[model samples]
Target: MESVVIFDSPGKGRGLKAAKEFWAGDVIFSEASIAAVVFDSLAERICHSCFRRQEKLQRCAQCKFAHYCDRTCQRAAWPEHKVECGAIKAYGKVPNENIRLVARVLWRLDKEGSMVSDMQLTTLDELEDHINDMQEHDLKELKVDVHNFLDYWPRTSKQHLIDDISHIFGVINCNGFSVSDQKGLQAVGVGLFPNLCLVNHDCWPNCTVILNHGNQSAVSTVFHSQQRIELRSLGKIAEGEELTVSYVDYLNLSEERRRLLKTQYYFDCTCEHCKNKTHDDVKMGGKEVDGVKPSDEQVKEATDYCFQMMDKMDKARLNGDYHEVSKICRDCIEKTEPILADTHIYLLRMWSTMSEVKAYLQNFEEAAEYARKMVDGYMKLYHPNNPALGMAAMRAGVTHWQAGLIEIGHGMICKAYAILMVTHGPTHPITKDLEAMRVQTEMELRMFKENEYVYYSMREAALKNKPMTMLHEPRSVEEGIKNLFHRK
Candidate 1:
């Protein structure tokens, strides 16, 4: 907040602008969550205080709902949980993430007495709800949530009018940021950071938002660090330049991106890419095969088929049927590869899914191959310093290393490190891990080059008694799919 000033952005509403020049990787600002809650579905898995996922968590004995990693985390979350514990028990079930979030915000507002502080740029009342812009179906769903929220609200607590409650829900719908886990991989919750909401969207943005789960060794620090976020410059920005981050994934074709933005955020994108349909050709490129080129109509037909396949794939994924998801991806790729270019969005999606599923199934060589293809397409489609590109490259690099392609693994890890240094900064846990990986891969490459025979002999001997599943965990595959599909 100190590094940037809130100002009226042209075309866009209010935006955060740089107060001074910022070099690539410089942190523009960092803010802790005003109010946050883990998704109910993940309540048991993720610590309520630190937002870290664990295999075993200590359940709050009193509430019998909230979970934490240790007494330290439990103590840290008590302030937030204290208000809702009795209400949740009386209500007989934990409300969904949305209702719980709304409750958290209300309780916090009651305690704080004011929504905006002296240094705050906007008040909670000032944040747009876009309720009027919501479609009929969405409004109906919101109404249901409001009803549930009212039922879940405790009678002794301060009450709010239905209109005000509904407005808060709309505001959250329009402004909430997806909070990621400690590794900046899987999304675990949703949070509201007021200053972050002031930033505007751009197809080609100059800033990236990272959910920073702080140092874990220091329990007190981790407690204080829950749901914190840092906004970093994607590249150089001069004084007074507006800081923007993409609300939607910019790698999608311009039309699809705009459609998503308009549908979700209630804004028509008029960014340069949207205005000019820039990179649409490359996104939707098609090629001829066996002296037969797909006509426009054929490509359109294939694209439609791919969309249907994607829906099925999504359902299978959500159902936790990785085998079915892999089958769908392979079938779609076989049908669309000839008619659609390898760079097509649908093709890339399939390649990404195939890679993760293959990795999950322990087919490392095939996983590495598909991951490499997905990373190559991402390189062509995303900004050179895009965080997503860096993440994908890191995944590909790890898959390659697991598959025993040392030279290629070293190269990809180095590439990922360079990109992440710009997008995630060197201090981020993911970037730090990538740096460690790069060092390991580099050493392995040198060893392999010096004596390929000796290197293989030693490596084989070392791994002979080790479990085949030890190279990569299934969670990594889960993280890959979650990161690609979920927003943050």
Candidate 2:
């Protein structure tokens, strides 16, 4: 609580304010969900109680609604599940995640309990709810669902149903965060973290959220037999500055990011990153707009071209036509690169796809180049230590090694491993996989280094009488060896 405060952010409405300056990687705070519901589609793989990926799970004998890792988790989750179980059973089918989430929210406001103060139901009352903005059919569906959830058939009061239900659903819509694992690769569930929700949206956020769903405990804390969502500073934050996180993924052009924010959160973003025209630069698009900014015409042209290329890439990928995808991706890159800069969100995906395609095709040198670009793009767009950037770094390292740049590849792997270690911890699958890569890279680096000295010495001996070579003119064997050493 001392780390942050809540106040009017003017154009942004209520926003969380930093109480003091904080550095990158600093933990602002951590809290578990107040009322989280694992989406039905993912429930089979993700635990209902702790949200961990479970292999050996047992169903609640009575309700058969949730699968838990063991008796302990089942018992721990019983209190919350008891009423929800009955509600779903009464519904005669599995309630969709939205309905279940709203039900849980209503229950918490009415009866559900939590172990943490920040997660208390009272903190949620002041949250924003866009009842007046909702569509007619959506409002009607929510009303019916709320009525069913609250068992309104037996109630005498009917006047407040529409208003109350709409308000609650609105709150959830505005504040709920789609939960993902530490790496943000899998959709696990959704939750209303009242305090985290208080942090306003910014296209270029100064903070990041990571959900830790592990059996291991933090150094100063016990692994609460539940999932934990931790918010950390992405970079240094000054006192009184508003703390913000991106509501939508930042790997999109300005227009797409705005579209997503408007559609999902129902708000217009005017953050500095959004206000800036050139977030990423254009190479040949009308008068270098500096960074990623393009003129209106350039924006439209790049947007249209990107969409067209994306459609082709998607269709080719779905059809398992890797060669077509690779070809189209290269065309997209070449076509867009001169007009669109590396910072363009479209290029990010293009570079990522190219890296994967080349890697699959065993064109290691080309794959390494694309992977490096992917890492560079992510580093520019994402917060420090983002899992995506870390993964990209690992990808670059592996491909660079495959391309015979062992020492450079090892260095990249080490960098990626360090970032992953801090963000994802030692036990996460991605972290462990990166750890394995780091070890292999180190082994290769050692072997390569060991041979390099002797090989270079022999080459030097043989080339002592030979002339040095220019970039284009290899005068002797020494020139070729030098070129190889420099990766020319």
Best by lDDT: 1
Clashes of 1: 0
Q: Model 1: per-residue lDDT, tens digit, 72-187?
A: 88887788899889999999988888888889988988888555355466778888889999999999999999999999999999999999999889988988888877777777
- Cα RMSD, each candidate: 3.1, 11.2
Candidate 2, backbone clash total: 8
User: How does candidate 1 fare on TM-score?
Assistant: 0.91
Pairs of residues at least 3 apart in sequence or in different chains that clash in candidate 2: 277-293, 278-292, 278-293, 279-292, 280-291, 280-292, 281-291, 281-292
What's the lDDT for candidate 1? 0.82
Note the clash tally of each candidate.
Answer: 0, 8
lDDT of each: 0.82, 0.67
Listed in order, each prediction's TM-score against the native is 0.91, 0.76
